[model samples]
Target: MYKRVLLKLSGEFLSGDSGFGISPDTTADLARLVTGALGGTGVELAVVIGGGNLWRGARNGKGMDPATADYIGMLGTVMNAMALQDAMEATGQPTRVMTAIQMHAVAEPYIRRRAMRHLEKGRVVIFGGGNGAPFFTTDTTATLRALEIGADVVLMAKNQVDGVYDSDPRKNPDAVRLDHLSHREVVERRLEVMDATALTLCMDKGLPIVVFDLFQEGNLRRLLTGERVGTLIES
Candidate 1:
């Protein structure tokens, strides 16, 4: 069981069936679920959300420069962070949105000590903007924050997949799911569970990661309760 956990949620998951932009209803539902899981447990929570639903750096601007595209993606993540913070607060949960880039009017500049203080007080902290630089993914940010904040585990919430598989489960009916793995094995096998940098960081820090299907009812709660419902990667 984790005393503190960092949840990594992709922005696309917030979009629901629309596949783009934030869906208030869906986000509200997610907020309820998160609050339910956190209620009375006193588990410290931090979140990192992706921006694929709004814009993906790799797919933006078509022929535009890569740096420009990535910047747009970073902006998109900030957008999601603000929305998620609002939704969480609406559910009566005190939440803070911290950005790697200093956007004072929009979010607090990321300060490690302040974030840890928020966690100690049971506030949900949402880290956004993807490292505030180009060529780095939110996955890496999640890993970095998890280690920096001394999180007990990182819960990776996938859209539908339950765990890491040898192959794409959608494409291969026979794809094998791994219930457990070592950090070394995940990297050596080239599994797509997390980005290479994130994987390496977890490995170095001996951080445990849980990969689970976020769409499954009560799975997040189960994960927080220490129920083994998905694959776990550990050192």
Candidate 2:
């Protein structure tokens, strides 16, 4: 099993089946999954959740300033982080909601050393605010956190998709799921795993990524147990 890992969760996942606002049922389900995975032993997990449900800079802010829209998206992520934190805490698991924008009233400031310390104490750290910068997606934030904290692997929890496919599976019935891929292959093939900048960072750092469906029963547990359950992208 990996000693430590970073899990990238999109805001749509927290919105549940409707793909909108937060859903208590889905949030509770996610909390239980993390609780089960951690069962007092296994990988040290850190989460980076997207704000697409509440805000999408490019998609929703067509007439607004690009940077301003991005900041709004970042704030949305913090809100989602707070809800997830509450649910995780209810599970009896120590979890911290760290924000890049320094929301002292709600979340602690993002300190690299302090985050590592939390992980050492078996606390699940959730990162929000999208690197505290505009024009950067949460994907970049996840990769940045993973690299800074020396994570062994990045577990990308997709909402419905099971793994990386050659093409859009929904549009193309013939799209094939690739079991494994190299970082270079992902880049060359232009896979939709992440943005170019974030993918490049992972390639530079030699960080492996596992893309899998979050709703798959026992999939998270299977991953924690070192059983391959998704498309593994490595160096």
Candidate 3:
């Protein structure tokens, strides 16, 4: 249903049931799912993944330097990018690992035109390093990249969460899942779909967002095909 989609993956998801690091099973499963989706449909795909499993930057306490912590986190993302790329390529899917920070030996520099070109050629592009700057989440990087590439929608792949709720479902029994929401509503209600900056960018660009459970089998493909799989936050 969508021409091109940017899939935002969290580092937490890559960590699988474990609280930290990559799980071979989880990474392989994701690679297969995404590659299968590409085979079935002609949707151009890109990815921006978080580095929470490794380090959360400024969020890390104990007076650590924010920029240095963020840089470490960015490097963690590069590790993730390389791992995902390997998995995809192993499954016969052409993939590119692009990074904001130039690591010539590992990933290509994030060049806007080149990235768009890779997408056009049906290669899955993985964006790493959180915009090559500190104080920005991968969520914001996904937003910016989606705009740059003219994506049809941003597919937010939450770990186990199905959608946006009025409160944390894990904590509140009465928390309500919102099936539909506007950008204004998300900001006004202070929903936890993504960072405020990222949502603001989406609002400015008139981009639609789908926040769904990535761990749920076939949910990603279902969301891409316009099936009801998760919360549709847009307009």
Candidate 4:
């Protein structure tokens, strides 16, 4: 089993059928699934969640200042982090919300050593605020945080996408799912596994990324057990 893993969750997964905003039921269900999967596994889990459900920087920055809009999007991720913390705690899971931006009132500051300590203590660390900078996607945050924490792998949990495909699976039914790919191949082909900067960081650092459908029951557990649940992108 992997000793430590960073889980990257899209905000869309927490929205459920509403397609926007956070859904309590969906968060609760996700909390249960995550807690259940990691229970008794002795794995150190850290999470980096996106803010697409509440705010999309590019799409929402139409008439607003780019930096301001991006900061607002970061705050939205803080909201998501809080919601997730509540859900996970409700399931008796110990979780900590760490933000790159300072918000001592709601969450702790993202200090690398402190984050590593939390994981070592067996607490789930949820990173928010998108690396406290503008013009960077959460994908990059996940990769950076994973590297900082020295995680064995990055688990990219998708909403419904089971793996990487040659084309958009929703638009093209004939799109073939690729179970394995090299980081160089992803960068060369411009696959949607993650943003270019983040994928490049992974490639340069040799950090493995596993993209899989989070909604699939037991997929996380299977992956932790080395059962090849979805796409494996690495060196």
RMSD of each: 1.2, 1.1, 1.3, 0.9
Candidate 2 similarity to native, TM-score = 0.97
TM-score of each: 0.96, 0.97, 0.95, 0.98
Instruction: Summarize candidate 4's per-residue lDDT along 83-108 as a digit string, tens digits.
Output: 99999999999999999999999999
Model 1 CA deviation exceeding 4 Å by range: none
**lDDT of candidate model 1 versus the reference:** 0.90
Query: What digit string (tens of lDDT, one per residue) describes model 2 on residues 1-235?
Result: 8899999998987887788899988888889887887785667989999998888989999999999999999999999999999999999999999999988999999999999999988999999998988988888999999999999988999867999999999999999999999999999999999989899999999999999997788888888878999899999
| Best-first order by lDDT | 4, 2, 1, 3
| Number of the top lDDT candidate | 4
Instruction: Give candidate 2's error at residue 139 in angstroms.
Output: 0.6
| lDDT per model vs. reference | 0.90, 0.91, 0.89, 0.94
Cα TM-score of candidate 4: 0.98
Clash pairs, model 4 backbone: none
Score residue 156 of candidate 2 by CA lDDT.
Answer: 90
Ordered list by TM-score, greatest first: 4, 2, 1, 3
Worst 10 residues of 4 by lDDT: 221-230
* lDDT for position 180 in model 4: 96
lDDT of 1 by residue, 104-156 (tens): 99999999999999999989999988787888889999999998899999999
